[model samples]
Target: MKKVLILSTALTSVAMAASAEEISVMSWGGAYATSQIEAYHKPFTAQTGVSVINVDADNPAAPIKAQVEAGNVTIDVVDLEYADAVRMCDEGLLEPIDPAILPAGADGTPAADDFLPGAVAECFVATIVFSTLYAFDESKFPENPPTTIADFFDTAKYPGKRGMRKGAKVNLEMALMADGVPAGEVYALLETPEGVDRAFAKLDTIKNDMIWWEAGAQPPQLLADGEVVMTTGYNGRFFAAAVAEGKPFKQVFDGQVYEYDGYAIPKGAPNMERAKEFIVFASQTQQLADQAKWIAYGPARKSSGPLVGLYQDGKTEMGPFMPTAAANLTNALPSSYEFWVDRDAELNERFNAWLAQ
Candidate 1:
């Protein structure tokens, strides 16, 4: 009888292990992924007994499209930029996510009303509002640090290597801004052919001095390694290096372009229902607010704001560091998703041609 009981227990153990479910999530790595792992993945796993696997990419959107088009979808949930999310949804590459699945805010507000404008879309639910901004190593410019977007392009003044993302999106807008275009008028100017030429013209000035980086984590590393004096990067990575790791990096918010980053399930995700459940859990007010504790990005849900307090360090407040903070928005530009969605391919093609030249 004891032998029989042991056999039954072993079989049960194997069955339970086999039944355990796991979902793969693809996101931009570095401090950003750490934030999600702590605030969303850990708690979600604890609550549901489902394992969460993280996959890192320079950008999640391309791999998602590739996997879906090839009809061998491996990633269950993917973090996406606002423009990519909208573009993919339009192409029917993402599964439709009903806002009804999200829970009400901690303050008892409904999900639809609680989420900031454009946070909830047909196939995407935004989790945080992040920004792309340039930061310089203070040690690199001890006397007169760069204070404006124009300084980023003034290779003659700054006189050092600069790091920039290997993409056209934020670079074009910043080029226009550095060339003296107002934040509100950037997209309008880009709509004209002359304006496109002007933006590219500005970029040409610093082309030789620029060290192109494609990954979110590369900027901070480049600055630390002294590969570049200044680099445009996501704000949170810089925050982690400076405040958390005691790096001498300082961020310049002038000409910053802020936008939303969110989660979506690819069409035909193997674990579609479970992926939906994970998104619902991650987008809740508390989870969103908790994410702010680890990174500087603002929570997308309005109710999540009040819950955002000190950073993980326990003393540093997160409000002033957020891209949406009042002080930071003085010359900041909200990235126009519509403009990118419409012009992405055309501009990128031109950008690639320019790069070749």
Candidate 2:
């Protein structure tokens, strides 16, 4: 009896040790986090017995920087926007991720070649190509529905409160686009003093009626709760609400600003090896494609494109909803990471000053 008791105690301790292994992934919450949970976390835990604990943030970049700078890094993995990833990597706040660790495409192409251009960075591995676009509650605009970027700015014609992100990046670009600046000319114009003034001048038109949102999740909720008739939000969030939840929201791809969002290990991560494994598993071709079923964001892997099928409901095709869809690209702008890397600080200062007025 004594021998049996000793063996039982030893077995339980081993089981507890195995189950205690977990990695923390910080990401933008709401529907986007759900997608990662379904497509990445669950499968990863099942395969490796290493659990994933999700940490939500309005934007993970700010917290990550703070964590790294303070030398108390709690998060093992972080989802970062492209420009933030580049900036943090340059500042040595993130661990260097070797592309060689990533698996090849389903078609057996090398990861370096299989990934979309700029998808694999020195310290980041992009998972999706998401777009920031404006969405409207269909019931709010039953007649003469908005169809252009300019329509989003026409308060007199639309007659409702507008929802926008409380940041300068997309707002400035969208303002220029609405003011009739071509997609190709937006960045060039933004570099000039007169152009920066012009963009703000356009925003001044709707400043009073603007309902600013800082999180990706808030825009859809603002529209659903009738706080705003039209709002800008991530394409995936709107798609999740409109399709999965059966909301009457409609997205306008016109003047959409699309960029890559992906995973990076924070410097001095406690679970560095496991974090790398999670990133490799999450960014696999099939895994990337599977994420599309849960959200409208395009997979970063080119091979994943053909494998993308229907939504989780198994009816609505996801191709046409992707930001990379041919029709949607007709009037879209690929976000410029280089431009943001150079001007984020100064422009944000100007934006904050304008907000105070």
Candidate 3:
């Protein structure tokens, strides 16, 4: 950080933000957005004297998906979503991570085995354990809390309108759980007629109370305004609101479905040599923890949480975010991009039609 530099999108460097070569990070764009580019990559440059630039993480403008498809990958580091990570790996758009290159610093972090199970199960490791929970305005539901996905659907017990994400991949697993399936059996059931049918049947029970959300901000607003007493929301989004902004809202991760969004080098990154260095540096446990502090999404390395002890300045971590919290793994969902990719069209069609009912 001694010889660092700083700069805004349209401005030049200010201080402690310098780096030899700038790394372009792919992520969302907005004012309150906690993009990896802005939070992790940008501050990393300021702190470690490394530099990173911001770019669109999704397709269309300088798209990573299209470029990877065209046999030329320009993005050095990518933030991969559930299926996106798997899709890139299968298509040879990601390079394998070699931890040996990324040595732990003075903190004795970057220790292996810290990442969540779903991430280690995949080639690309976890950067953040993002979850979808039934969030509510505590003021309205002062006497009650929604714990499980089943409670999410039960308007009788909960007794209020609900907001639902339109996307089916995560919701399907959730729907299955609400229908009385356990976490271990979610995927197994999806593989059978009974599982898929049971989930849809449960969803049909609350179709009337459901208000479809089109974007990430939709559910939060739907909750903040009391439009719906409870709704499915991303942990980071609610973390920003409830914890960071001190909003009177609470999120129940008891039956939450957690998803990982983290770094994966393109199969043939133009700057493979430099890309590898960035990956190793970014994956350092504390660095992941530092990034997590800004978002409240748990880091890949378990050491990050206990070692860093750096809570995001304002956010309150949901009980489940703690490594030893009382989490409801029984109803948790691990979205399989592979399965969704294959059955997306058919499954989504079936699920979306059911949502309309």
Candidate 4:
């Protein structure tokens, strides 16, 4: 068995060498991956002749930690949330990415200066500013659409199964917001035991009516298949389905929780050099801006903002749909990476136990 496995690996390696160098990048699949593929992978492959093999995970951060600890790292680069990036870097699970390797913005500003605040961390280079927002099928509530976070929890009025991600982070915050706690006070309130109870109690309101999802791709499909009427999902996925695929979806940006998602190399990735090259290439001004065309995620670089224009359909403007847009910011909450980094494990454990009950 060992011999056969070794021979298979050897033959695969030989084949790869004869064809092209390939780096595996694990990301949340669906429209998000498609955006990266169009904006980064194809262009990078064309420029360097190093093919990119895309991989998907429910959460890329988990597999990265497992692979590094097991001494069998295979993924060259992973897309991760800011908190996971910071946590893994602190735990020595990821490679330290030097900012010097990144290119200057289109306007000639240094990479460090050009990227938005907290966009670059010790182990990651933030690529996009995305949001976790709930959207409903237009067909679900035709007369009166869900316009606010509170409306999402009003199952009595709306009358349908709700979709939520199978995790604690966004759900807790949303629960607080839906319960009428101001966005500014969410994390502060969450710091107290009473506040935690309040959030959980609010979540209990829709617990029975909830359909939990793991992958970013699931929510759109859940909505499409009529499995759910309204679901919290990455804003980009909703944009792709509604705009690109012409599905009957509508984004409810009110009380949206936005965060940075970026690329990090696991400590011992086989193609370290290629991974670095890919990161630098993908983090460039044009590439980041180009990504916005395919999805609603905002580029992390300030220079890229001006470059973002129409969507892939070439008619719809992308600016108003972004989480960073002025109109969208009215009821938005920027996720605190520091808060999540500190409490992720304890909260997740509590969340799992709550789910089991």
Candidate 1, residues 1-357, lDDT tens digits: the string is 999999999999887565448999999999999999999999999999999999999999999999999999999999999999999999999999988899999989999899999899999999999999999999989998999999999988898999999989999999999999999999999999999999999999999898999999999999999999999999999999999999999999999999999999999998888899999999999999999999999999999999999999999999999999999999999999999999999999999999999
RMSD of each: 3.6, 3.5, 7.1, 4.1
For each predicted model, how many residue pairs clash, with residues at least 3 apart or on different chains?
0, 0, 12, 0
lDDT of each: 0.95, 0.96, 0.66, 0.95
TM-score of each: 0.95, 0.95, 0.78, 0.94
**How high a TM-score does candidate 1 get?**
0.95
lDDT of each residue in 106-191, candidate 4, tens digit only:
99999989999989999999999999999999987889788999999999989899999998999999999999999999999999
Model 4: colliding residue pairs? none
**Whole-structure CA lDDT of model 4:** 0.95
Worst 10 residues of 2 by lDDT: 14-23
- What lDDT tens digits, residue by residue, belong to model 3 across residues 167-209? 6777778888777778777887898887788877877888888
Worst 10 residues of 1 by lDDT: 13-22
Poorly placed runs, candidate 3 (over 4 Å): 1-20, 29-39, 47-50, 56-63, 70-74, 104-123, 267-270, 308-310, 314-324, 327-346, 353-357
Predicted candidate 2 versus true structure: per-residue lDDT over 1-357, tens digit per residue: 999999999999897676449989999999999999999999999999999999999999999999999999999999999999999999999999998999999999999999999998999999999999999999988998999999999999998999999989999999999999999999999999999999999999999999999999999999999999999999999999999888999999999999999999999997899999999999999999999989999999999999999999989999999999999998899999999998999999999999998
Which pairs clash (backbone N, Cα, C closer than 3 Å) in model 2? none
RMSD (Cα, Å) of model 4: 4.1
